[model samples]
Target: MDIVEAVKTRRSIRRYEPRDVPKEIIVEILQLALNAPSAGNRQPWRIHVVRDYRLKELLTDAAGGQMFIMEAPWVICVVAVPEESASRYGERGRSLYCIQDTAALITHILLLARNYGLDTCWVGAFDEKKVAEVLNLPVGHRCVAIIPIGYAGEPRKDRPRKSLSEIAVFHE
Candidate 1:
């Protein structure tokens, strides 16, 4: 699908079917995710693909019983490696663009997945410590987002969004 079409149609999907996503498709999504731009070309992100049902259940608990985390066929944990930036840009880096870059990439991945006929919900509220433990995240890495992906269970209706004039400014 065209990028514009995908962006307009993509919505936060909360319900999913009980089918499994193909391995190749998952790989494709990850590939697109890594293509996201970063500061000074230093990509500092690691993704954890959680497919185990037991682990998914644990994630739901960590997310305060969002429940949909367990229903989706796949959950991905996006982790940011801040050290990658600190080593290159020094003290200025940690206070800089690493988090924003990682976030942009995740957003790109979600849009790409939506275009591929998959659905996702970006989960930002969760127990970081539990997520780190469950995903076995390495030291110095922070969990940035938890995304649930699968076939969307319900047809989407557009959510309320601000008008263009309200959010955008014209520069002369």
Candidate 2:
């Protein structure tokens, strides 16, 4: 699908079909997503691809019992290593640049999944400490987003969006 179509069609799919997404496809998506620009090419993100049922259950609990996380065959945890960017850009890199870079990467993953006829939800409501423990994250690594990816079992209605004029600023 084209970028415009992908953006328009992408939704926070909570219901998933009982089917599996090919491993290669998932890898390909991640590989392409890595191309997302980073602050000074530090690539402060680390992706944890979770397919184990037990781990998914743990993640569901960490996410305040978001059971849809278990329904999807795969859960991707986007980790941000602030130090990676901080090494070059100092405090601002740790506080902002890493987050901005990871957000870009997350957007790429979501749109790329849509291009593959898959659905995904960008889940951020979770216990950060619990997620870090569950995923065995390294020191200074933070879990920024938990994405559940799969084939959609239900249709999603479009959510309302603000008008361009309402959200955009003009200088010219």
Q: Tell me, what's the RMSD of every candidate? A: 1.2, 0.6
lDDT per residue, candidate 2, 1-172, as tens digits? Answer: 9999999999999999989999999999999999999989999999999999999999999999999999999999999999999999999999999999999999999999999999999999999999999999998999999999999988977999999999999999
* Residue ranges of candidate 2 with Cα displaced over 4 Å: none
lDDT of each: 0.88, 0.96
Best by TM-score: 2
Compute each candidate's TM-score over C-alphas: 0.95, 0.98
**TM-score of decoy 1:** 0.95
Tell me which residue pairs clash in candidate 2: none
Candidate 1 lDDT, 1-172, residue by residue in tens: 9999889989998899888889789899898778899999988788889899999998898899998889888898888888888889886666566788789888988998888899999999999999888888888788889999999988877999999999999999
Highest lDDT, which number? 2
Worst 10 residues of 1 by lDDT: 91-100
**Candidate 1, residue 73: CA error in Å?**
0.8
- Where does candidate 2 have its weakest 10-residue lDDT segment? 152-161
